[model samples]
Target: MADLVTPAERRRLYTLLSPAYLWLMVAVFLPLSAMLFFSFLTDMPQDAPDWGVTLGNYAEFLSNPTYGTLMAKSLKLAVTVTLFCILIGYPCALVLAKSIKGRAREALFLMVILPFWSNSLVRIFSWAIVLRGNGVLERAINWVLPFDVRLNLMFTTDAVVIGLVHSYLPYVILTSYLALQAVDDDLIDAARSMGASKLTILRRILLPLSLPGLLAGAVLVFVPVVGSFMEPRILGGRMGTYYGTVIEDQFVAVYNWPLGAALSFILLAVVIVILAAASPVLKRAQT
Candidate 1:
Protein backbone atom coordinates (compact mmCIF):
# COMPACT_ATOMS: atom_id res chain seq x y z
CA MET A 1 0.00 0.00 0.00
CA ALA A 2 2.84 2.39 0.80
CA ASP A 3 4.56 1.53 -2.47
CA LEU A 4 1.36 2.12 -4.43
CA VAL A 5 0.86 5.63 -3.10
CA THR A 6 2.50 8.38 -5.15
CA PRO A 7 4.60 10.95 -3.26
CA ALA A 8 2.20 13.82 -4.07
CA GLU A 9 -0.86 11.82 -2.90
CA ARG A 10 0.93 10.80 0.30
CA ARG A 11 1.91 14.43 0.93
CA ARG A 12 -1.67 15.52 0.33
CA LEU A 13 -2.96 12.91 2.74
CA TYR A 14 -0.43 13.95 5.39
CA THR A 15 -1.38 17.59 4.88
CA LEU A 16 -5.02 16.72 5.43
CA LEU A 17 -4.19 14.74 8.58
CA SER A 18 -1.65 17.23 9.97
CA PRO A 19 -4.13 19.22 12.04
CA ALA A 20 -5.44 16.11 13.85
CA TYR A 21 -1.91 14.81 14.42
CA LEU A 22 -0.84 18.22 15.72
CA TRP A 23 -3.83 18.35 18.05
CA LEU A 24 -3.01 14.89 19.46
CA MET A 25 0.62 15.86 19.99
CA VAL A 26 -0.37 19.02 21.85
CA ALA A 27 -3.40 17.74 23.74
CA VAL A 28 -2.41 14.16 24.59
CA PHE A 29 1.28 13.45 24.11
CA LEU A 30 2.53 16.69 25.69
CA PRO A 31 0.75 16.08 28.99
CA LEU A 32 1.71 12.41 28.98
CA SER A 33 5.36 13.30 28.38
CA ALA A 34 5.27 15.81 31.22
CA MET A 35 3.68 13.22 33.53
CA LEU A 36 6.27 10.58 32.62
CA PHE A 37 9.02 13.10 33.39
CA PHE A 38 7.38 14.04 36.68
CA SER A 39 6.89 10.40 37.71
CA PHE A 40 10.64 9.96 38.32
CA LEU A 41 11.10 13.25 40.20
CA THR A 42 11.42 13.58 43.99
CA ASP A 43 9.62 16.94 43.91
CA MET A 44 8.35 19.49 41.45
CA PRO A 45 11.27 21.69 40.25
CA GLN A 46 9.16 24.77 40.98
CA ASP A 47 8.47 23.70 44.57
CA ALA A 48 11.81 22.46 45.91
CA PRO A 49 15.37 23.76 45.38
CA ASP A 50 16.92 20.32 45.96
CA TRP A 51 14.38 18.44 43.80
CA GLY A 52 15.93 15.57 41.91
CA VAL A 53 14.84 12.52 39.90
CA THR A 54 14.10 9.45 42.03
CA LEU A 55 12.44 6.01 41.74
CA GLY A 56 10.96 6.35 45.25
CA ASN A 57 7.48 7.23 43.98
CA TYR A 58 7.17 3.97 42.08
CA ALA A 59 8.96 2.16 44.88
CA GLU A 60 6.23 3.29 47.25
CA PHE A 61 3.65 1.61 45.02
CA LEU A 62 5.54 -1.68 45.33
CA SER A 63 6.04 -1.20 49.09
CA ASN A 64 2.44 -0.22 49.86
CA PRO A 65 -0.35 -2.81 49.69
CA THR A 66 -3.18 -0.25 49.88
CA TYR A 67 -2.70 0.83 46.25
CA GLY A 68 -2.95 -2.79 45.13
CA THR A 69 -6.16 -3.32 47.13
CA LEU A 70 -7.76 -0.20 45.72
CA MET A 71 -6.62 -1.12 42.18
CA ALA A 72 -8.27 -4.55 42.55
CA LYS A 73 -11.49 -2.92 43.80
CA SER A 74 -11.55 -0.54 40.81
CA LEU A 75 -10.89 -3.40 38.37
CA LYS A 76 -13.70 -5.44 39.94
CA LEU A 77 -16.07 -2.50 39.73
CA ALA A 78 -15.11 -1.96 36.07
CA VAL A 79 -15.72 -5.61 35.16
CA THR A 80 -19.09 -5.64 36.97
CA VAL A 81 -20.24 -2.46 35.24
CA THR A 82 -19.06 -3.65 31.82
CA LEU A 83 -20.85 -6.98 32.25
CA PHE A 84 -24.10 -5.30 33.30
CA CYS A 85 -23.89 -2.92 30.35
CA ILE A 86 -23.37 -5.82 27.95
CA LEU A 87 -26.19 -7.91 29.43
CA ILE A 88 -28.62 -5.01 29.33
CA GLY A 89 -27.44 -3.00 26.33
CA TYR A 90 -26.87 -5.86 23.86
CA PRO A 91 -30.50 -7.01 24.05
CA CYS A 92 -31.69 -3.46 23.58
CA ALA A 93 -29.37 -3.12 20.57
CA LEU A 94 -30.62 -6.38 19.13
CA VAL A 95 -34.22 -5.27 19.41
CA LEU A 96 -33.51 -1.87 17.88
CA ALA A 97 -31.53 -3.33 15.01
CA LYS A 98 -33.56 -6.45 14.16
CA SER A 99 -37.07 -5.91 15.53
CA ILE A 100 -37.99 -2.24 15.57
CA LYS A 101 -38.30 0.04 12.56
CA GLY A 102 -38.88 3.64 11.41
CA ARG A 103 -39.62 6.46 13.88
CA ALA A 104 -40.01 4.04 16.79
CA ARG A 105 -36.41 2.93 16.39
CA GLU A 106 -35.24 6.54 16.22
CA ALA A 107 -37.20 7.41 19.37
CA LEU A 108 -35.85 4.36 21.21
CA PHE A 109 -32.29 5.18 20.05
CA LEU A 110 -32.75 8.71 21.40
CA MET A 111 -33.88 7.28 24.72
CA VAL A 112 -30.85 4.95 24.77
CA ILE A 113 -28.56 7.96 24.45
CA LEU A 114 -30.64 10.28 26.67
CA PRO A 115 -28.16 10.07 29.53
CA PHE A 116 -25.55 11.86 27.43
CA TRP A 117 -27.85 14.90 27.17
CA SER A 118 -27.49 15.65 30.89
CA ASN A 119 -24.36 16.78 32.67
CA SER A 120 -22.55 13.89 34.32
CA LEU A 121 -22.71 15.55 37.75
CA VAL A 122 -26.44 16.09 37.38
CA ARG A 123 -26.93 12.44 36.46
CA ILE A 124 -24.87 11.24 39.42
CA PHE A 125 -26.67 13.54 41.86
CA SER A 126 -30.01 12.43 40.41
CA TRP A 127 -29.06 8.84 41.10
CA ALA A 128 -27.97 9.90 44.57
CA ILE A 129 -31.39 11.37 45.19
CA VAL A 130 -33.18 8.25 43.92
CA LEU A 131 -30.95 5.75 45.73
CA ARG A 132 -31.03 7.45 49.12
CA GLY A 133 -33.19 6.09 51.92
CA ASN A 134 -36.93 6.45 51.26
CA GLY A 135 -36.04 8.03 47.92
CA VAL A 136 -37.86 7.67 44.62
CA LEU A 137 -36.83 4.06 43.96
CA GLU A 138 -37.67 2.87 47.48
CA ARG A 139 -40.96 4.75 47.44
CA ALA A 140 -41.86 3.35 44.02
CA ILE A 141 -40.99 -0.20 45.09
CA ASN A 142 -42.97 0.22 48.33
CA TRP A 143 -45.90 1.57 46.37
CA VAL A 144 -45.83 -1.34 43.90
CA LEU A 145 -45.41 -4.06 46.51
CA PRO A 146 -47.87 -4.92 49.28
CA PHE A 147 -45.19 -5.13 52.02
CA ASP A 148 -43.20 -2.24 53.45
CA VAL A 149 -39.56 -2.25 52.34
CA ARG A 150 -36.81 -0.01 53.61
CA LEU A 151 -34.45 0.21 50.69
CA ASN A 152 -31.41 2.35 51.07
CA LEU A 153 -28.95 1.77 48.23
CA MET A 154 -26.95 4.98 48.55
CA PHE A 155 -23.35 4.82 49.77
CA THR A 156 -23.07 1.22 48.61
CA THR A 157 -20.92 -0.49 45.98
CA ASP A 158 -24.17 -1.42 44.21
CA ALA A 159 -25.00 2.26 43.82
CA VAL A 160 -21.63 2.92 42.23
CA VAL A 161 -22.13 0.03 39.80
CA ILE A 162 -25.63 1.22 38.95
CA GLY A 163 -24.48 4.77 38.22
CA LEU A 164 -21.51 3.64 36.15
CA VAL A 165 -23.65 1.21 34.17
CA HIS A 166 -26.27 3.81 33.45
CA SER A 167 -23.64 6.29 32.35
CA TYR A 168 -21.82 3.87 30.00
CA LEU A 169 -24.61 1.62 28.77
CA PRO A 170 -25.25 3.80 25.71
CA TYR A 171 -21.76 3.06 24.36
CA VAL A 172 -22.49 -0.65 24.28
CA ILE A 173 -25.94 -0.23 22.74
CA LEU A 174 -24.78 2.14 19.99
CA THR A 175 -21.80 0.00 19.01
CA SER A 176 -23.77 -3.24 19.10
CA TYR A 177 -26.60 -1.68 17.15
CA LEU A 178 -24.25 -0.55 14.38
CA ALA A 179 -22.73 -4.05 14.19
CA LEU A 180 -26.13 -5.75 14.28
CA GLN A 181 -27.45 -3.40 11.62
CA ALA A 182 -24.65 -4.35 9.25
CA VAL A 183 -25.67 -8.04 9.26
CA ASP A 184 -27.57 -8.77 6.08
CA ASP A 185 -31.22 -9.52 6.81
CA ASP A 186 -31.14 -11.94 3.88
CA LEU A 187 -28.67 -14.10 5.80
CA ILE A 188 -31.11 -14.29 8.69
CA ASP A 189 -34.00 -15.10 6.34
CA ALA A 190 -31.97 -17.84 4.66
CA ALA A 191 -31.12 -19.31 8.05
CA ARG A 192 -34.79 -19.25 8.99
CA SER A 193 -35.68 -20.99 5.72
CA MET A 194 -33.15 -23.71 6.62
CA GLY A 195 -35.09 -24.29 9.89
CA ALA A 196 -32.61 -22.50 12.12
CA SER A 197 -34.02 -21.40 15.42
CA LYS A 198 -33.69 -17.74 16.50
CA LEU A 199 -31.39 -18.80 19.35
CA THR A 200 -29.23 -20.84 16.98
CA ILE A 201 -28.97 -17.98 14.50
CA LEU A 202 -28.10 -15.51 17.24
CA ARG A 203 -25.47 -17.82 18.71
CA ARG A 204 -23.86 -19.00 15.47
CA ILE A 205 -24.29 -15.90 13.34
CA LEU A 206 -25.13 -12.58 15.02
CA LEU A 207 -23.04 -13.00 18.15
CA PRO A 208 -19.88 -14.02 16.28
CA LEU A 209 -20.29 -11.22 13.76
CA SER A 210 -20.92 -8.56 16.40
CA LEU A 211 -18.19 -9.68 18.82
CA PRO A 212 -15.89 -6.86 17.70
CA GLY A 213 -18.48 -4.17 18.36
CA LEU A 214 -19.38 -5.71 21.72
CA LEU A 215 -15.68 -5.77 22.63
CA ALA A 216 -15.33 -2.17 21.47
CA GLY A 217 -18.17 -1.14 23.72
CA ALA A 218 -16.71 -3.16 26.62
CA VAL A 219 -13.35 -1.42 26.16
CA LEU A 220 -15.06 1.98 26.02
CA VAL A 221 -16.91 1.27 29.25
CA PHE A 222 -14.09 -0.53 31.10
CA VAL A 223 -11.34 2.01 30.46
CA PRO A 224 -13.27 5.04 31.75
CA VAL A 225 -15.09 3.21 34.56
CA VAL A 226 -11.77 1.86 35.91
CA GLY A 227 -10.49 5.43 36.18
CA SER A 228 -13.82 6.91 37.32
CA PHE A 229 -13.92 9.01 40.51
CA MET A 230 -16.89 11.32 40.18
CA GLU A 231 -19.77 8.84 39.89
CA PRO A 232 -18.35 6.59 42.59
CA ARG A 233 -17.65 9.51 44.90
CA ILE A 234 -21.12 11.00 44.56
CA LEU A 235 -22.96 7.69 44.67
CA GLY A 236 -20.82 5.35 46.82
CA GLY A 237 -19.87 7.97 49.46
CA ARG A 238 -17.51 6.23 51.93
CA MET A 239 -17.55 3.09 49.76
CA GLY A 240 -16.28 5.04 46.74
CA THR A 241 -12.63 5.24 47.76
CA TYR A 242 -11.10 3.37 44.83
CA TYR A 243 -7.72 3.70 43.09
CA GLY A 244 -8.98 6.59 40.98
CA THR A 245 -10.11 8.56 44.05
CA VAL A 246 -6.70 7.87 45.60
CA ILE A 247 -5.04 9.28 42.49
CA GLU A 248 -7.35 12.32 42.62
CA ASP A 249 -6.47 12.86 46.28
CA GLN A 250 -2.77 12.62 45.51
CA PHE A 251 -3.05 15.34 42.86
CA VAL A 252 -5.52 17.57 44.70
CA ALA A 253 -5.62 17.08 48.47
CA VAL A 254 -2.06 15.76 49.02
CA TYR A 255 -0.46 17.90 46.28
CA ASN A 256 1.96 15.08 45.53
CA TRP A 257 2.32 15.52 41.76
CA PRO A 258 5.26 13.12 41.44
CA LEU A 259 3.45 10.32 43.24
CA GLY A 260 0.27 11.08 41.33
CA ALA A 261 2.16 11.01 38.04
CA ALA A 262 3.74 7.69 38.96
CA LEU A 263 0.34 6.26 39.88
CA SER A 264 -1.22 7.60 36.68
CA PHE A 265 1.63 6.18 34.58
CA ILE A 266 1.27 2.82 36.30
CA LEU A 267 -2.45 2.83 35.50
CA LEU A 268 -1.70 3.75 31.87
CA ALA A 269 0.76 0.85 31.67
CA VAL A 270 -1.81 -1.56 33.12
CA VAL A 271 -4.48 -0.39 30.67
CA ILE A 272 -2.04 -0.71 27.76
CA VAL A 273 -1.13 -4.25 28.81
CA ILE A 274 -4.80 -5.19 29.07
CA LEU A 275 -5.59 -3.78 25.63
CA ALA A 276 -2.51 -5.45 24.15
CA ALA A 277 -3.57 -8.80 25.66
CA ALA A 278 -7.04 -8.37 24.17
CA SER A 279 -5.80 -7.33 20.71
CA PRO A 280 -5.52 -10.89 19.39
CA VAL A 281 -9.14 -11.58 20.38
CA LEU A 282 -10.29 -8.40 18.67
CA LYS A 283 -8.31 -9.28 15.55
CA ARG A 284 -9.81 -12.77 15.55
CA ALA A 285 -13.29 -11.25 15.73
CA GLN A 286 -12.46 -8.91 12.90
CA THR A 287 -11.28 -11.83 10.73
Candidate 2:
Protein backbone atom coordinates (compact mmCIF):
# COMPACT_ATOMS: atom_id res chain seq x y z
CA MET A 1 0.00 0.00 0.00
CA ALA A 2 2.84 2.39 0.80
CA ASP A 3 4.54 1.60 -2.49
CA LEU A 4 1.30 1.98 -4.51
CA VAL A 5 0.65 5.62 -3.55
CA THR A 6 1.73 7.87 -6.43
CA PRO A 7 2.65 11.58 -6.12
CA ALA A 8 -0.87 12.62 -7.12
CA GLU A 9 -2.48 10.29 -4.53
CA ARG A 10 -0.17 11.69 -1.85
CA ARG A 11 -1.18 15.24 -2.84
CA ARG A 12 -4.87 14.23 -2.71
CA LEU A 13 -4.39 12.68 0.70
CA TYR A 14 -2.76 15.85 2.00
CA THR A 15 -5.59 17.90 0.44
CA LEU A 16 -8.21 15.69 2.18
CA LEU A 17 -6.57 16.40 5.55
CA SER A 18 -7.49 20.08 5.07
CA PRO A 19 -10.77 20.13 7.05
CA ALA A 20 -10.57 17.63 9.90
CA TYR A 21 -6.85 18.03 10.27
CA LEU A 22 -7.26 21.78 10.60
CA TRP A 23 -9.79 21.30 13.40
CA LEU A 24 -7.55 18.75 15.13
CA MET A 25 -4.57 21.04 14.81
CA VAL A 26 -6.57 24.02 16.02
CA ALA A 27 -8.43 22.40 18.87
CA VAL A 28 -5.73 20.01 20.09
CA PHE A 29 -2.23 20.24 18.64
CA LEU A 30 -2.20 24.01 18.20
CA PRO A 31 -2.97 24.62 21.87
CA LEU A 32 -0.36 22.08 22.84
CA SER A 33 2.12 23.77 20.59
CA ALA A 34 1.24 27.13 22.09
CA MET A 35 1.67 25.63 25.54
CA LEU A 36 5.11 24.37 24.69
CA PHE A 37 5.90 27.77 23.25
CA PHE A 38 4.64 29.64 26.30
CA SER A 39 6.39 27.32 28.72
CA PHE A 40 9.60 29.06 27.64
CA LEU A 41 8.15 32.57 27.90
CA THR A 42 9.05 35.10 30.62
CA ASP A 43 8.70 38.76 31.71
CA MET A 44 4.93 38.48 31.71
CA PRO A 45 2.21 37.36 34.07
CA GLN A 46 0.38 34.13 33.16
CA ASP A 47 -2.52 36.16 31.68
CA ALA A 48 -0.42 38.92 30.17
CA PRO A 49 -1.38 39.94 26.64
CA ASP A 50 2.23 40.03 25.50
CA TRP A 51 4.40 37.41 27.17
CA GLY A 52 8.11 37.56 26.41
CA VAL A 53 10.11 34.45 25.52
CA THR A 54 12.24 32.94 28.30
CA LEU A 55 12.83 29.75 30.35
CA GLY A 56 11.51 31.11 33.64
CA ASN A 57 8.65 28.59 33.96
CA TYR A 58 11.06 25.69 33.56
CA ALA A 59 13.52 27.25 36.00
CA GLU A 60 10.82 28.05 38.57
CA PHE A 61 9.54 24.47 38.50
CA LEU A 62 13.06 23.17 38.93
CA SER A 63 13.93 25.62 41.72
CA ASN A 64 10.66 25.51 43.66
CA PRO A 65 10.52 22.87 46.39
CA THR A 66 6.71 22.78 46.48
CA TYR A 67 6.36 21.63 42.90
CA GLY A 68 9.27 19.24 43.40
CA THR A 69 7.58 17.66 46.40
CA LEU A 70 4.26 17.39 44.60
CA MET A 71 5.92 15.69 41.66
CA ALA A 72 7.62 13.19 43.95
CA LYS A 73 4.42 12.48 45.88
CA SER A 74 2.44 11.95 42.68
CA LEU A 75 5.10 9.56 41.36
CA LYS A 76 5.20 7.69 44.65
CA LEU A 77 1.43 7.36 44.74
CA ALA A 78 1.36 6.08 41.19
CA VAL A 79 4.03 3.47 41.96
CA THR A 80 2.29 2.29 45.11
CA VAL A 81 -1.09 2.02 43.36
CA THR A 82 0.46 0.16 40.44
CA LEU A 83 2.11 -2.30 42.79
CA PHE A 84 -1.13 -2.90 44.67
CA CYS A 85 -3.01 -3.46 41.43
CA ILE A 86 -0.38 -5.95 40.28
CA LEU A 87 -0.40 -7.87 43.56
CA ILE A 88 -4.19 -8.12 43.80
CA GLY A 89 -4.81 -8.48 40.07
CA TYR A 90 -2.20 -11.21 39.48
CA PRO A 91 -3.76 -13.62 41.97
CA CYS A 92 -7.31 -12.88 40.85
CA ALA A 93 -6.36 -13.38 37.20
CA LEU A 94 -4.52 -16.57 38.04
CA VAL A 95 -7.47 -18.07 39.88
CA LEU A 96 -9.93 -17.12 37.15
CA ALA A 97 -7.68 -18.41 34.42
CA LYS A 98 -6.91 -21.74 36.11
CA SER A 99 -10.33 -22.69 37.44
CA ILE A 100 -13.23 -20.95 35.70
CA LYS A 101 -14.19 -21.57 32.10
CA GLY A 102 -16.92 -20.67 29.57
CA ARG A 103 -19.83 -18.58 30.86
CA ALA A 104 -18.65 -18.65 34.46
CA ARG A 105 -15.35 -17.09 33.48
CA GLU A 106 -17.14 -14.48 31.39
CA ALA A 107 -19.46 -13.68 34.28
CA LEU A 108 -16.57 -13.34 36.69
CA PHE A 109 -14.74 -11.05 34.29
CA LEU A 110 -17.91 -8.95 33.96
CA MET A 111 -18.18 -8.67 37.71
CA VAL A 112 -14.64 -7.33 37.83
CA ILE A 113 -15.43 -4.86 35.06
CA LEU A 114 -18.94 -3.84 36.16
CA PRO A 115 -17.70 -1.00 38.35
CA PHE A 116 -16.06 0.65 35.34
CA TRP A 117 -19.27 0.64 33.27
CA SER A 118 -20.71 3.55 35.27
CA ASN A 119 -19.28 7.05 35.52
CA SER A 120 -15.98 7.21 37.42
CA LEU A 121 -17.46 10.07 39.46
CA VAL A 122 -20.16 7.73 40.67
CA ARG A 123 -17.56 5.18 41.67
CA ILE A 124 -15.63 7.79 43.64
CA PHE A 125 -18.85 8.93 45.34
CA SER A 126 -19.72 5.32 46.14
CA TRP A 127 -16.33 4.91 47.77
CA ALA A 128 -16.89 8.11 49.72
CA ILE A 129 -20.15 6.72 51.09
CA VAL A 130 -18.52 3.41 52.01
CA LEU A 131 -15.46 4.98 53.61
CA ARG A 132 -17.28 7.64 55.62
CA GLY A 133 -17.25 7.09 59.41
CA ASN A 134 -20.80 5.73 59.55
CA GLY A 135 -21.26 4.58 55.94
CA VAL A 136 -23.19 1.41 55.15
CA LEU A 137 -20.15 -0.81 54.66
CA GLU A 138 -18.71 0.45 57.95
CA ARG A 139 -22.01 -0.15 59.67
CA ALA A 140 -22.16 -3.64 58.24
CA ILE A 141 -18.67 -4.34 59.50
CA ASN A 142 -19.60 -2.97 62.92
CA TRP A 143 -22.63 -5.23 63.03
CA VAL A 144 -20.44 -8.24 62.28
CA LEU A 145 -17.89 -7.25 64.88
CA PRO A 146 -18.49 -7.61 68.63
CA PHE A 147 -17.51 -4.03 69.45
CA ASP A 148 -18.33 -0.58 68.07
CA VAL A 149 -15.54 1.14 66.24
CA ARG A 150 -15.13 3.84 63.58
CA LEU A 151 -12.92 2.96 60.66
CA ASN A 152 -11.12 5.96 59.18
CA LEU A 153 -10.90 4.90 55.59
CA MET A 154 -11.83 8.13 53.81
CA PHE A 155 -9.99 11.40 52.97
CA THR A 156 -6.45 10.12 53.10
CA THR A 157 -3.63 9.01 50.81
CA ASP A 158 -4.67 5.43 51.45
CA ALA A 159 -8.19 6.04 50.16
CA VAL A 160 -6.84 7.60 47.00
CA VAL A 161 -4.57 4.61 46.54
CA ILE A 162 -7.47 2.24 47.05
CA GLY A 163 -9.60 4.11 44.54
CA LEU A 164 -6.85 4.09 41.95
CA VAL A 165 -6.18 0.41 42.48
CA HIS A 166 -9.86 -0.38 42.20
CA SER A 167 -10.24 1.71 39.08
CA TYR A 168 -7.32 0.05 37.22
CA LEU A 169 -7.52 -3.45 38.66
CA PRO A 170 -9.75 -4.69 35.87
CA TYR A 171 -7.17 -3.81 33.26
CA VAL A 172 -4.53 -5.76 35.14
CA ILE A 173 -6.84 -8.74 35.59
CA LEU A 174 -7.88 -8.80 31.94
CA THR A 175 -4.35 -8.55 30.65
CA SER A 176 -2.88 -11.00 33.11
CA TYR A 177 -5.78 -13.42 32.70
CA LEU A 178 -5.29 -13.46 28.94
CA ALA A 179 -1.60 -14.16 29.45
CA LEU A 180 -2.35 -16.90 32.01
CA GLN A 181 -4.88 -18.51 29.70
CA ALA A 182 -2.32 -18.71 26.93
CA VAL A 183 0.19 -20.57 29.13
CA ASP A 184 0.65 -24.24 28.28
CA ASP A 185 -0.89 -26.53 30.90
CA ASP A 186 1.46 -29.23 29.73
CA LEU A 187 4.37 -27.23 31.10
CA ILE A 188 2.85 -27.35 34.55
CA ASP A 189 2.04 -31.05 34.25
CA ALA A 190 5.59 -31.72 33.20
CA ALA A 191 6.94 -29.73 36.13
CA ARG A 192 4.71 -31.68 38.51
CA SER A 193 5.76 -35.02 37.01
CA MET A 194 9.36 -33.98 37.46
CA GLY A 195 8.73 -33.59 41.21
CA ALA A 196 8.37 -29.81 41.25
CA SER A 197 6.17 -28.45 44.02
CA LYS A 198 3.17 -26.21 43.30
CA LEU A 199 4.93 -23.18 44.76
CA THR A 200 8.01 -23.81 42.64
CA ILE A 201 5.92 -24.20 39.50
CA LEU A 202 4.12 -20.94 40.21
CA ARG A 203 7.19 -18.88 41.13
CA ARG A 204 9.44 -20.30 38.42
CA ILE A 205 7.06 -21.02 35.57
CA LEU A 206 3.89 -19.06 35.99
CA LEU A 207 5.31 -15.69 37.01
CA PRO A 208 7.95 -15.69 34.31
CA LEU A 209 5.52 -16.86 31.66
CA SER A 210 2.98 -14.22 32.63
CA LEU A 211 5.47 -11.34 32.48
CA PRO A 212 4.19 -9.73 29.29
CA GLY A 213 0.62 -9.43 30.53
CA LEU A 214 1.89 -8.15 33.87
CA LEU A 215 3.94 -5.46 32.10
CA ALA A 216 1.00 -4.46 29.93
CA GLY A 217 -1.26 -4.28 32.98
CA ALA A 218 1.30 -2.30 34.94
CA VAL A 219 1.59 0.32 32.18
CA LEU A 220 -2.20 0.55 31.89
CA VAL A 221 -2.52 1.07 35.64
CA PHE A 222 0.39 3.44 36.28
CA VAL A 223 -0.02 5.93 33.41
CA PRO A 224 -3.53 6.99 34.42
CA VAL A 225 -3.01 6.63 38.16
CA VAL A 226 -0.36 9.34 38.01
CA GLY A 227 -2.74 11.74 36.29
CA SER A 228 -5.87 10.94 38.31
CA PHE A 229 -7.67 13.92 39.89
CA MET A 230 -11.20 12.93 40.99
CA GLU A 231 -10.10 10.02 43.15
CA PRO A 232 -7.80 12.29 45.10
CA ARG A 233 -10.24 15.18 45.25
CA ILE A 234 -13.06 13.09 46.72
CA LEU A 235 -10.99 10.68 48.79
CA GLY A 236 -7.75 12.50 49.65
CA GLY A 237 -9.19 15.21 51.91
CA ARG A 238 -6.40 17.48 53.26
CA MET A 239 -3.65 15.02 52.42
CA GLY A 240 -4.85 14.75 48.83
CA THR A 241 -2.78 17.79 47.85
CA TYR A 242 -1.97 15.95 44.67
CA TYR A 243 -0.34 17.62 41.67
CA GLY A 244 -3.40 16.92 39.54
CA THR A 245 -5.39 19.22 41.78
CA VAL A 246 -2.77 21.91 41.30
CA ILE A 247 -2.93 21.54 37.56
CA GLU A 248 -6.73 21.72 37.71
CA ASP A 249 -6.69 24.82 39.86
CA GLN A 250 -4.16 26.60 37.67
CA PHE A 251 -6.12 25.91 34.51
CA VAL A 252 -9.69 26.33 35.81
CA ALA A 253 -9.75 28.48 38.94
CA VAL A 254 -6.70 30.74 38.66
CA TYR A 255 -6.78 30.84 34.89
CA ASN A 256 -2.98 30.80 34.85
CA TRP A 257 -2.83 29.37 31.39
CA PRO A 258 0.92 29.62 30.86
CA LEU A 259 1.81 28.22 34.27
CA GLY A 260 -0.79 25.49 33.93
CA ALA A 261 0.55 24.66 30.53
CA ALA A 262 4.04 24.57 31.94
CA LEU A 263 3.00 22.31 34.78
CA SER A 264 1.16 20.02 32.38
CA PHE A 265 4.15 19.78 30.07
CA ILE A 266 6.44 19.11 33.01
CA LEU A 267 4.13 16.27 33.98
CA LEU A 268 4.28 14.92 30.46
CA ALA A 269 8.07 15.03 30.66
CA VAL A 270 8.01 13.11 33.91
CA VAL A 271 5.75 10.44 32.42
CA ILE A 272 7.96 10.15 29.36
CA VAL A 273 11.02 9.71 31.55
CA ILE A 274 9.37 7.01 33.64
CA LEU A 275 8.11 5.15 30.59
CA ALA A 276 11.52 5.32 28.95
CA ALA A 277 13.13 3.90 32.07
CA ALA A 278 10.56 1.08 32.25
CA SER A 279 10.46 0.31 28.52
CA PRO A 280 13.48 -1.97 28.61
CA VAL A 281 12.06 -4.00 31.47
CA LEU A 282 8.71 -4.32 29.71
CA LYS A 283 10.33 -5.35 26.44
CA ARG A 284 12.56 -7.89 28.19
CA ALA A 285 9.54 -9.34 29.97
CA GLN A 286 7.78 -9.80 26.64
CA THR A 287 10.79 -11.60 25.18
Model 2 score (lDDT): 0.87
Q: How many residue pairs clash in each candidate at the backbone level?
A: 0, 1
Worst 10 residues of 2 by lDDT: 38-47
lDDT digits (tens) for residues 1-287 of candidate 2: 38746899888887887999889989999888987886777633545767687767777788889998998899899999999999999999998998787999888889999978989999989899988889877899999999988888888888899888889899999999989999999999999999999899899999999989988999898888777788998999888987888888877888766677788889999999989998898889887
Best-matching candidate per TM-score: 1
RMSD to the native, candidate 1?
A: 1.1
Q: What do the candidate models score in CA lDDT, each in turn?
A: 0.94, 0.87
Segments in model 2 whose C-alpha atoms lie over 4 Å from true places: 1-31, 42-47
State, as a TM-score between 0 and 1, how close model 1 is to the true structure.
0.97
How high is each candidate's TM-score? 0.97, 0.87
